[model samples]
Every structure is written in C-alpha cells, then in structure tokens.
Target chain A: MRLNLGLKTLSIFTALLLVAACETAPTETGDSSGGGATTQTSGSGSTTTVVTETKTTTVQPGSQEDLVLNVGDRVFFGFDKYDLSDEAQATLQRQAAWLKANPTVTLLIEGNCDERGTREYNLALGERRATAVKNYLVTLGVSADRLSTISYGKERPVALGHNEAAWAQNRRSVSVVN
Target chain B: MIGSVQKIRTLLAGLVLAIALASVARAELVIDITQGNIEPMPIAVTDFYADNEATAKIGKQMADVIRADLERSGLFVPIDPRAYLQQPKDLQVTPVFANWRKIAAQALSTGLVRALGDGQINVQFRLWDVFAEQYLTGIQFTTPPSNWRLTAHLIADAIYKRLTGEDGYFSTRVVYVSESGPADRRIKRLAIMDQDGENHQFLTSGNELVLTPRYSPTQQVLTYLSYFNNKPRVYLYNLDTGQQEILGEFPGMTFAPRFSPSGNQVVMSMAQDGNSEIYLMDLRTREMKRLTNHPGIDTAPSFSPDGTQITFESDRGGRQQIYIMDADGSNVRRISFGSGNYGTPVWSPRGDLIAFTKLTGGKFSIGVMRTDGSQERILTEGFHNEGPTWAPNGRVLMFFRQIPGKNDGRSDKVSLWSIDLTGYNEREVITPGDGSDPAWSPPYNLNR
Candidate 1:
C-alpha cells in the first residue's frame, strides 16, 4: 500500500510537474530556449541527439562536509533546454542533500538565460528552469514551501561580454539561498 | 633569387597575421549598448508640399507634431527645420550626402504633401539613415485634410520604425482619463489623440467620470472604467465600429481594465464596497473569473506573455508593493521588495522587465525592476513622474510628469514623456492638449 501510494504520488507529481514545469506552478510561464537550441557541432559535422532534457536528480544522504558541491556556479543549456546533464544532476544531487540536512534553510532560485531570446520569454523560461530544480528537491523530501523562484531572464547578467563564454555563464540558474 | 624567395615567405606570414588580427577585432568590438545616448536624434522637419488651404494648414501643423513626437523620445535631437539644407519638396529626388554630413546630421526626415483629387490629401515621408546612406522607409497615406495631423503622425511613425527597428508610437493613439478642476468639481473625460499630439478627440467629453482607458491587444477597441449613473462599470469601445459595450454588470465597481496579450480576455480590478481584488472577464462569453480575493488592494494586474501568470501591485505586505500570481491566482509571491513603494507594474511586451511607478522619499519616479525583487533600478526620477508604458521594442518607457505648484499652481501641465531604459534619452511625447497616463499599444496586427 505504501509503495502504491508512492507511485501514485509520483505519477500525480509527474503530471503536475510537467503542467507546472516545476515542483510548483508560478503563473503563466513559457520555456522558450530564448530561441531554439544552437546545433552543437561534434568535430565531424554530425549532430548529437537530445537524450535527456532534465536529469532526474536524487539527493544523496550526506552532510555539508560530505558534499563539496560544485553546483556549477554556472550551467549551460542548449538554447532553451532546462534539462540537466549527467554532470548537472551530480551537482544538483549534492546541493539537494545539503538542503535535506538544512531544514531551517530557505532558498531563492534565480532563473537566467542567454541574450539570444526575447526578454520576457527568456525570463519565463528561466523561472521554469529554477522551478524545475526546486520541484526536484521537493520530491527528494525537501520542503516545497522553502523554495522560491524568480526569473532574471537576460537582465542581471554575470558576464557582459557578448561571446560564447559569457553566454554560457549567463545561461544558468544560480541557487541563491538564505 | 635567395632574397626574393625569403620575401615571398615573409609576405605569406604577414598576410596570415593580418587576417588573424582582423578576426580578433571583430570579436573584441563588443559595444555593450546596454544604454544609449538618450539625446534625441537631431532631425529637420520641413513643410511638406501642400495643395489647398486645409492641406497647407495641416502640413505645417503635422511638421510641428512630428518634431514634438521625435523630441519627446529623448532619443532624437530635433534640428531646426529653418536650418534645413534642402526643402522637403526637393527631397523627392536625392540629397547631397556631403552637405547633410557637413551639418553633422546623422539622420534626416524628408516629406511631401499632395492634394488627392477626392478632396483629401496624401502625405509621403521618408526617414534617411544618414550614416548608412539609405532610406529606412518611404510611406504614403491618403486622408481627409482634417486628418493632416494623423498623416504627419503616420510619417513620424514610419520614420521612427525605420530608424529604430521598432514600431513608431506616433501614429498610434493614447486613451487616458483626463482630470480637470478641483477635487470637488473634478471632471473626468476619456480623451483620445494621435501619438504625435494632434487630433484631440474626447470620447466621454468630461461629462462622466472615467478612471482608466486601456487599449485592446489587437484592435482599436478600448476597455476602461466609467462611473455612469453612479455605478462604476467596465466598458469597451470599438473605435472603428463605433460600438460601445459594457464588459460585465457586476453590482460592485470595476476599474483598471487591461486586455490580455491575446486580446481575448480583459483583466481588471473590481471593488465590492471596501473590498477590492482582481478579476478576468472573457469578452466573448462574459464569463468572469476572480483571480485575486485578498481584502487588500490587489489591483493593476498585467499578464505574462504566455498568459499563464500575472504581475500586480498590492498592499498585501502591509505596504503598496508588487506581486506575482499564477493565472488561477495561486502561489502568490512578492516580486518587489526594494525600499520604495511600487505600483502600476506593467509587463513588457517582450515579457522581461516590468515598468512601474515608484514613490520613494516622497517623490514619484518611473522605474523597472526584474521579475524577482533584486536589481531594482530607477529609470527616471522627478517630483511627480508616474505611470510608465513600454514601447513595443521594450527599449523605451513612456510616462507622465507634472510640474507641481509651478506657474502659480494655475499651469498644471501633466504631459506625456518617454525615456530609454538607460535613463539618458528623455523626451516629452507630443499629445493634443495636456496629456497624461500614456499606454503604448502593440504593433498593429488586425487593428489597422
């Protein structure tokens, strides 16, 4: 019965998650990758298929000392994909475990994107990405009420240079927690 | 032979080095035009060639109107047409680039007025990108001589869009609630005009009290509040169809009507006695959905681009601030938490920044903050500057400022103005008579 309840809840959450595009829904949000993704060239001119947009991140049981999470100070998605890479999940899992231990903690998840898309669209997408991470943590037993999301879109940029490095850094969601 | 062979090798290396340096320059020239010199583009507006007396009268009036429209942009510095190099009539052929460049003009406007045989006038205008040495656009419109002002406005819009790569607000119109006289004898009217400050038409004629006049998302339809027969009601006006319809006849007062981004629904604030909240009504079905139920003043709601979420100004946090709620009015979160009080949160057409009115230090200023409460930057500051509407490109903000207690308190000129996001380009928008509370419309889709 417990297992059935867990599966039922998971499926319910899965449906709600896609509809809300987060662990929770904030009002009308559209996740356009600003524009579509830039086809990444892998040396021989062929393209890589989109295997996973967002990786299912699981918080490993640990203390802060056990997880010196890179949390990527930055993560780059293709155009507008808010999905996590294998590396991104590893970083998120560590951060998730930290939040699991720190129950009294509250966080501000800031959604951000590159300068490639329209401002409003990028902002909504950013919010959606952060909400995705927040929802993943909620499913991992972290309290959903503690996580709040806001989209910076292309406004508050970390790097001002209009280059690949700058765009890579800017197209990321930083987990700002208090 | 040895020396010649060595020279060829050296030349090849030098050529390769040059190409590398050129490519690096292309990458390094990152002019972060986050802000531009908001100084108005210097322009010359000569009298368009007119035919009849009415056309001649309109030609001069429209030239003045275009000048005012561009000057208010704070982006263009209007040059005195008296100092023009060539008459607008001569501009039909070509212009001497050297002379224009000599006058230090980066952009110029040339137009001609023609008398259509059907007792109407046709005006043609073009904006020249002097630096690019090309015409941004050449537009011709035929209207009755009385619409000379609109024709001038159309010319200004064409010039504006061509140069800025955005739709011009000049040919557009502003529907605002005009207030006059003292608080006891205050008269309110739904006033309309060409974006260039001509053709002042009063829809309500100051006989009835109107609160807000918001433009429809797709058409010339205007949705606003009217206190007709002492009952505050939401009303809609189809400018072309000459049709006026009531949105919903709720028992309470309804105000602050704004069309959704798709133009299918109208979101507004309704008050039942002392209780106020936000609601959305489908124009087709007349079905109303209450989005906010807080006893606090939850008003001034604007939808996100996709219409799934909304941003509004509320006093829920014990003070007037900005909040974001879901489309169903769930998961309400506060988006503004800076020191100042914020209201009239307008979502950008591009859906990024929210233009708002901020009252800090007892002064009203127009500003924009990110969707979250961080990085709140004030764009324009004044004693009484409020109500910011974003240009279609999300580059400029239009608002109004009044010189309080100036000219012995008799000359209370609350006029429309615009400024770039960078706070540099500040210009007084041209409007017929004194204007206030300007709202920019989206690009004309089916509305025109």
Candidate 2:
C-alpha cells in the first residue's frame, strides 16, 4: 500500500510535466546547459523561451497508477446524496474510456460515505453511490461483467476531519483496478 | 480472556427460613421505578462475616461489588460503611433495627462467606426492611472461590428484584465494540465485559474492522459484521469455544445482522450491485429466505420478541423510516412518520416499545415509541448518537455517543452510555478506552 502511494505521487509529478510540456513548445532543443533545455513558444507575433528540464518517466498504461494519475480513480458526492454531479460524471466518462482501452482489467468500485449517517443507512446509501458509478460506466460501454461494487458505509474514510471539506472528500466512490 | 471462571452453582439455603420469616411481616418496603423521577432508596451493606483472613478479604470485596451494583442501577444508594453502627460480626444474629433506622437507612443487606474445604465456598446473603423490621428475602450460592464477583451480583439481583418488582441486570454481560486509534483509521475489536465493566476481554484482534455485535438468545453466541480479508460479511462467534465463521455465502457485502429471539435464525441485509435487501437464514438448515424484494434499501432488521413480526428501516417510502412487517414478509407498513430519518429500529424485549436512532436538524437522538408508532419520546439527543440496545428487562437502553472531533477529527472519541426507559439516570459505562455498539445479554442463569 505504501509503495502504491509513492508510485501514485511519482506519476502525478510526471503528469504535471506533461501539462507543462503542453504550455511550452512541442519540440525541445537537444542542446542543454547544466542539464536543462530551452523551448520557445511562438504566438501572437511574439516568441518566448522557457528553460526547464525536459525529462519524463513513463508510467505503464492501463495500470492502477495510470488510472489514478490520468483518468481519475474517484469522484465525490454531496452530503447524504448519492446522485452523480456533472463533475463526477465527467470523471466517470474518462474512467469508462480508460477501461475500454484496458478490457482485461477488472474494476472494483468501492462506495464510501461521510460519517454523518447511521451505519446501516449509510451502507445502503454507499451502495447506491457505487451503483450510480457502475451504471454510468455501463452506459459508456463498459461491461457489467468487468465491474463489481462494495460500500464502505463510512467504515473506510479517506479524509479524517469533522468539517465539510473532509466529509466531501470522504464521501466518494473509487474505481480500483484489480 | 479474564472472565473464564466456571459457571455459578447455586444452592438455595434460606428459602424455607426466609418464607417462614416473611409470614409474620407487615408494611413491606418497595420501590416503584416506573415513575419518571424518584428518590434513590438508602440501603446499608455490611462486609460479609468470615473466619479466616483470606475468606474475610473475599467477603469484603463481595460486599463492595454488591454495593456498586445496586448504586449503579440508580434505584438504591448503598450507605457508607463508616456510618454503619453494626459490624460484620454483629450481623450474625440480626441487624439491630434501631441502629439502621437512626442512620436513615430504609433497607439493610448482610451476608456471610464460609469455605467448604474443597476450594469451594458457600455465600449467603439476606435483605432486611429497616422500618418494617422484617426479613425480606435470602439466597445462598455454592461455587468456586473465584466466582465471588458473580455471587455478589446474584445477591444484588435478588435485592433489586425483591424491591423493584423487575429483574435486576447486574449478573448480565455486555458485548461491545472497543475502539481506539484515530477517526479515519480506527481500530475496532469485539470486546465483552461484565455489566459493571469488569473482566474485560477482547474477543477479536483489531486487525480487521468489526461492528454491530448482537448477542444470541443463549448468550453464548454472537452475530456481527466483519471486514475479514476485505470481504465485508456477517460472521457468527461462539463465546465458549472462541470460534468464528461467516454466516452465509454472498456475492456482495452482507451486514446489519441480528439473531432471532429463538436463536435458530438470523436476519440481515445483503447488498449486491447497488440494491440492498433483507433476508433471513435458518441456522439449522442454511435456507435463505428473501424477506424484502424492493429496489430501495432495506436493512437493520430486528425481530419482535414473539418472533411474529420484524421491524426494520427502509427507504422504500422515499426516505429512511422505520417499518414493520409480518414474519413471512407480508403486511409491510411504515411505522415512523417523525420529522427526520429513522434507522436501527430495535424491538423492545417486552414487545411494547421500539428503540431507534433519529437524525433531525443535523443532530442525532435516541428515542422510543410504542409498537403502533405512538407516544414518541426522545430519551437523549446530542451531536451524534446511534445504535441503541435494550437491557433484557426493557426498562433501560444502552447506546454509543460520539463526541465530534475538533479540528482534524483526530480527537474524535466514542463511548457507551445507558439511560433508563423513563429517560433518567443517564450514566456512562466506563471502559478501558472508547466503546460502541453495546449489546446486553439476558439475565444469566446462576446455575449455569
């Protein structure tokens, strides 16, 4: 588990570099000064040169780290509500596309809830949340056979705070590649 | 594993003598506990008389245990021994009524412990009405010396039942979830202790998450939910043998399990895909019956004492509410029409009231209503309270209350508390650390 988190962090770093690469020139000069390269972006009749290290560590596609870093592995819900928001659906769309590309990878959708609800009711609510994600993915052409669900029901929490910020993070459904 | 003492062996020594003494009694003293508020009866307890030093020490400990038991019930206040005018040795014949009355004691309890030469001892106790100047009742227990604590509880139970006209809950055990660590990654283990929080033992290691443990009718078995090997499922445990097993074969998560009153069946919820439905499994035959076939979530099923009806919380009516149906999944009707969401509706053992947790206005309250869903009374309310379990007598309810965490929620704490059915005498049941989801066992059989 610790190793996975570290790798997730590393892939997130790699993703930031790719985003930076998009803002700069598409091509990098092979000549480097002190292990750095300069890229020029030309637009609006002006040219700007940006200096940075142009190095990237490629993460294996269709892997758990790839899902976390690129397509988003989880989506949040409102307090005591399981209906998917537009943002959650957008994330699920990317996840569905990713799953289509990696057909052999089975996904475990874990439904979770904030600690505000009772244990049993939250169990039901969490299941609904997970099912909402699964149903949406199915509409996006992901097979039902490749997707399974479980509700943590506030038992497993990602954020441990009493305020809304933590609760919003805790109430989510994460798609785990198994 | 400290509460491994052998079961008690009872020998009623003073039954004939106490009955003979009761024949000449007048103006019997009694406590009416059904009222909302009443003064606690003042009772005097003396150390049990013993000859040897070792036996005398046990006698004194027994006296202290009995006094604590009676005091915790909130029906009696055991007087200070320093104010007692009669010593242990002086109570061999009878308690001087004048000395006890001068101290304003309404009742007196005295006992004697004698070793019977085989690592066994005979503990005898008697309750006396001070103002009436008459003997009330007496009993004797023959058991190993290590069972002195149980002997004291038995004496307290006898005194309580004799005065209050209700069974005493002293000799019972409580199985609960002992929690520790932080809020996001809490460690919960199954733990059992005496009603007074003695003999604390953790039934399961905290390696996995466990919750909502319910005791069987036999008191030797429990059914709870566990996240074993990351497969959330219902599991059964045998107290005597320390054996655990999954309750059923399910493709998804199975939780909110409770044993039937007959101890031969279990009713629980199995969540597959996104729908949760209630089901009943016969323990003997392993036959599973689907009780509710709705798309809405239905869980937290508890059976009425008679086993003719089952009460559960469901969202079939658009939101979480308490509902009751026949034992065979017929005549389903919604019983809760309160202001907020209701869940965890536990049927009272007396078949009269149902206890539940209600969330209203962003707060949680423990309340009870009649079987017909009338006379709804909120016993206690706070920032967060859930899961109310009744004592066997149905006159008290124990629930867990969580103190909301400050800042990061790392300071979050949960503890077990009990309140009278009359909504009085709310006291915290002290545990080694934090506790939750307490289930009270039925009154133990002294002979067992």
- DockQ (CA atoms), all models: 0.01, 0.30
Q: How far off is residue B177 in model 2, in Å? A: 1.1
Q: What is the lDDT of residue B241 in candidate 2?
A: 91
Q: Write model 1 residue lDDT over B67-181, tens digit each, in one string.
A: 8777776556778776777766566655665667767777767666777678756676655556555544465665566666656665676667655666666655566656565
| Top-scoring candidate (lDDT) | 2
Candidate 2 lDDT, B263-316, residue by residue in tens: 999999988778899999999998889999898899999999999999999988
For TM-score, the strongest prediction is: 2
Error of 2 at B258 (Å): 0.6
Off by over 4 Å in 1: A1-178, B1-40, B44-64, B87-90, B116-136, B142-146, B241-244, B402-416, B425-436, B442-447
TM-score of chain A of each: 0.58, 0.70
Chain B alone vs. reference chain B, TM-score for every model: 0.79, 0.96
Evaluate all candidate structures by whole-model CA lDDT and list the values in order: 0.62, 0.82
Give the DockQ of candidate 2: 0.30
Candidate 2 lands at a TM-score of 0.90
